[model samples]
Target: MSHDARVFLREFLRDPARVAAVAPSGRRLSQVLAGAVPRRGVALELGPGTGAVTDHIRHREPRRHLAVEVNPRLARLVARQWPDVEVVCADAAELGPVLDAWGAARVDAVVSSLPWALMPEAQQRTIMTAVQAALTDDGCFTTYAYVHALWMPPARRLPRLLRTAFTHVAVSPVVWANVPPAVVYRARAPRRDVRAD
Candidate 1:
């Protein structure tokens, strides 16, 4: 297994709630998430465990790439591996200040691997609100949901939350190559003046 997979596994074992994936994201899913970004401005990545998606973000050559990981070990590893990347060990909901510290008010793309299925509705709303607020008007937020979990109440409710927050939301075809088969959800930030709060 790759080092990233090993590190991700270690972190997942440490706290499954924090790192909810069964395994590190595969190359295909990473490609899809990274490519979903329409432009190359400040890109914010949430839950970049082991840098699986971070590599692809760098490959896309965004103007500035920032990753926030709740896992301290994973955050350290990402910073060590990608010395230039701004890797912060914090919650995704702190996006606004994190961006401000970097002299950025908006991000063009947000690639997240957060375990939305595992979070409570209130927590999900808080993070989603932060994500919506952090994005630029034309920004896109790309995240995936496990195919098998679609029937779950939280999974079903995810769309409703997104629709309430964004101007458009698109679901990509299932990526069978991923360990547990997943589909990407790409949401366009609302064009109207809106505050997620």
Candidate 2:
């Protein structure tokens, strides 16, 4: 196994609920997710496991890059690997405050590797609410769902939740290269009035 995969496995073994996947995201999926970041603009990444997507995001060369990781070990690893990125070991649900504390009133893009399918509805709403609040008027938010779990309740509920949060939500075609396959959801024009309730 590659170094990243090994680390991902270890993290997943330690906290299956948080680390969700047994391996890091594939290059193709990472590229698709990172593509949402606007060049030279501020970018925020949630749950950058083993820096797979982070590697691609850095190539976009955003003026500022901030990553929020709930796992301390993974956060430290990502920080060490990507020195330029601002790594914060905290819950993604606190995205609003994290951005506020970082002095980034709004970010141009949000690339998330968070496992929304594994999250409870309330948790999903909480994080999505914070994401909407942290994005700029034209900012884009990109996240993905495994194809195999599309019929699952949490995954099925995601689109409805996203539609309520953002004015535009576009689903990508299946990325078969990824383990278990997945589809990206790119959302824009966050509805300012939407709140987690």
Candidate 3:
């Protein structure tokens, strides 16, 4: 694990109240996020943990990325890991300010590895709201949940909640090649005409 990932795991395992920030063990989710994202537009990432997803984002395209991490230590680590990436130390709920600071009026996509299942419903709603507002009309949001006990019904509530705010949403399984298998959720902003008005 990377330094930031180790720190995140230690903090998360020590206190459930603190947000969990484990890195994506494999690149499956990252691949999906890259594939779903646009080529030359800005991308936003929440709880990047240690640049695991950032690495993929860099490799896939030349577009700029803004990675928001609440953990200051992790933010510094990510800065070191990806010198070209803009690592900001801020909460996902306050994404608007971060995007503004980056001069990014609208994001092409939002990819995250935040532990949505562990957060309160209200916080979840807030983060989702911020993400939707920051993304363009046709932007996308992608995230993943562990495939173990973490993949229960309650865990699925995030994707369901996303549907209410987005016109297109999907969940795909990323089998056990990871330390634990995972499922990725991709959500797109509502378009005025999906079936053509």
- Top model number, TM-score: 2
Report clash pairs, candidate 2: none
lDDT per residue as tens, model 2, 59-125: 9999999999999999999999999999999999888788889999889999999999999998999
| Alpha-carbon lDDT, every model | 0.84, 0.93, 0.73
Of the pair 1 and 3, which is ahead by TM-score?
1
Worst 10 residues of 1 by lDDT: 188-197
Alpha-carbon runs more than 4 Å astray in model 3: 1-8, 11-24, 150-154, 191-197
Error of 2 at 30 (Å): 0.4
Candidate 1 global TM-score: 0.94
Tens digits of per-residue lDDT for model 3 on 3-24? 5567768756765454543434
Give the candidate order by descending TM-score. Answer: 2, 1, 3
Off by over 4 Å in 2: none
Q: What CA root-mean-square deviation does each model show from the true structure?
A: 1.5, 0.9, 4.0
